[model samples]
Target: MSPSHHGTEPVFDVTGVTKVYTSGEVEVRALAGIDLQLFAGEIAVLLGPSGSGKSTLLNIIGGLDRATSGSVLFNGRDLTDFSDRQLTRFRRDHIGFVFQFYNLIPSLTAWENVSLVTEVARDPMTPDEALAMVNLTDRMSHFPAQLSGGEQQRVAIARAIAKRPEVLLCDEPTGALDSKTGVIVLEALTRINTEFGTTTAIITHNAGIQQIAHRVFQFLDGRIASMHVNEARIAATEVEW
Candidate 1:
């Protein structure tokens, strides 16, 4: 779906956020003073190279990691002040994550793997329902090894979204796949964002993928270097480098 203009508060409102990792004689800053917002029903793409901190910012926003300083507000609540337990609960209740690698359990079938998370979610859709979103209903009974790379990634996407989370954070969701397979994965993601209205943030090295986002943020040296709205957005099926 196109970005909504119903005038809701931002899902994520971050300001001057920072993250630093100390290693003896050296200190590495993963994020340096970032200010950004992910509005409801918006698709944002984080475009940058290996050390640009795009993933670091995504992790913080998704509650997978904490910022070293500044504010991280989720719908007006200060996430920076949340306790570890609170952060855990927040992630469980509000966020879904998809990574580049298909982290599906080798022993479990697609349905079983997705079921594992839905069972614990507060208001989850059925495993079959989730699988259908990623167009994997026909292959739900297949084990991870039985599927193609794209199919496995689709299963992973199903597992992430089955919980009906308000936001979906994806870190290089197509990174490990070839362009043809990557297009299918991106299509799945675009479908999820449209059908569920899940505020989405994707981190990718492929600048071509920016065409699918409502807004594109370019990161460099641990900071956002540039950002722009894509007025002429295109479908993922039409994306090409």
Candidate 2:
């Protein structure tokens, strides 16, 4: 299938996208006229300090939020026009998300948590395959409280990928972990992107994580300050703290 049809074509096509929030009489411009394109089978890193609009852009693309103006197209579908119901369906069928906190259900075992997504997915991988991808096969029966921080994050990754979503969006995925543990989590993410050909986008303040990306975009004051293509990405394990 063409990338346009299956999100295999440039995974994202963002054009002149802008977001503005009005709180009483005050208006906050979270994104200012941004244009970008990202492709599948690659890892893209978004770098910026706090309040730089990195999170805003990620949210719009992931369908968690909407842009006030401009266009966001995934594959060829114009996301700007999608209704709330349509966005939910799109997110359910095509997107997976990871956040700084490992948002696992406290009552569920690792395997049970990972299996939740598959139950709602159109065509999903088995929980065992997803756990194995993150090297958490042995911890399937463990609960989140019983696992280490890194292990819990791996279970989160397993849950996200078990649905076999075409896109994986991560925001400050390692912010809550130590550098050493974070790298291990990143390795699992890298493995998922490489092995499944999932289009991956990561937002982080840590420049150290950029070494693993095929492309990097830097945001500043609600705009893209710079962008670069990395010919070679260093392994996550090789990144320096």
Candidate 3:
């Protein structure tokens, strides 16, 4: 499905963004210079190998990390200029992040894990509603240890969506799961995007997953090598590793 370019303004406008990590005398450039636009309500798949700077760019846009140079504008506001407190609020109020590992508190039930976000969000769905989004309402009371890996990931997704974020940033969300289980997680992600019209960006090593996105970006050596619109997007179930 093609994403709706509802407005001329992009959700995220990244320009000349670069990231450099320093350790002692060594300075490693993670991002050379990135110029990208993430439109509102679009599913963008970033494909690259390890150390390709896809994750670094994702982190910068998500407000998890700062760029060494250049500007990152979110809805016309310059994120790179924001104070630490403002960045924290920006992440909490607008961005939902899902990492490769399901970072659930083992002691917390699925419902509780999701509730943790709803409790702090400005306008959040109920934990029940979030669990229902992932088709995990029946397992809401189960602990993470009792659930399978896919189930745990779904719960983590539920927690992220509970806050009704405007943007969902996922870094290798399905990397830890098998092909069968990964598709299940992808289904949940696509469903959420369709339902909420959330601007979603996913970084994945699985090139096949790009077929499910509205647009695909190929990263190489800390820069975007190529980008294209997927005119004939497929469903999550149709994606293969």
Candidate 4:
């Protein structure tokens, strides 16, 4: 997880990636010829308006969906050619996803929710350790209903990272929270990215969150309209959002 371990290899190499959704009488292009490289141990933020294709690209990169044309390479392997089973195993063994909703089991304690993934992971950290990483160790036995929104989201993050995945892809992670609560959640994510060196990519509608990322890619009309590096990265607590 050290910065030293991050070599020149790109974690993701996407080329000519395009996604087209077909219905009865219409074909919608969600992504258009996206060619980019995401390096190891870097935090990349994808920003755009609704239907701008940021979420679509995130899903494709996370293995939840596939590009209709072109190739997606992860560490030199072509993901576009991977079978269903291969994609499932790739997601299970190497990717972690967080969405706007916590999606925690109401009946299970925080510890139990995270343990579910640890049980299936190849070399997972303990549920307790995962919870502690998000600073929720004291609430290990608390149910989702018993915790606040941010706490629940942290638990969800714990569950995602319990498997020790190399990539953490979060889609609208703080969309449902108030500003104060959202800041805490962002801080937790920042901490996790720094501590684990997990290559993190966040899809957010909030433009203010761009300051927190090492690099930002702005999507528009199904293409990356702009991309820039934040030489002076802002901490989550200091982020204007």
> What is candidate 4's lDDT per residue for 101-156, written digit by digit as tens?
99999999999999999999999999999999999999999999999999999999
**What C-alpha lDDT, on a 0 to 100 scale, does residue 126 get in candidate 3?**
100
Clashing pairs in 3: none
lDDT of predicted model 4: 0.91
- Ordered from best to worst TM-score, the candidate numbers read 3, 1, 4, 2
Q: Which stretches of model 3 miss by more than 4 angstroms?
A: none
Every candidate's lDDT? 0.93, 0.91, 0.95, 0.91
| Candidate 3 per-residue lDDT over residues 1-241, each given as its tens digit | 6866765799999999999999999999999999999998889999999999999999999999999999999999999999999999999999999999999999999999999999999999999999999999999999999999999999999999999999999999999999999999999999999999999999999998999899999999999999999999899998887
Estimate candidate 4's RMSD in Å. 1.9
Between prediction 1 and prediction 4, which has the larger TM-score? 1
Which lDDT value does model 1 have at 118? 96
| TM-score, prediction 3 | 0.98
Instruction: Locate the minimum summed-lDDT window of 10 residues in model 3.
Output: 1-10
Poorest stretch of ten by lDDT in candidate 1: 1-10
Q: Rank order by lDDT, top first?
A: 3, 1, 2, 4
Q: What's the distance in Å from true for residue 109, model 4?
A: 0.9
State which candidate, 2 or 3, has the greater TM-score. Answer: 3
Which sections of candidate 1 miss by over 4 Å?
Answer: 1-6
Q: Give the number of the best model, judged by lDDT.
A: 3
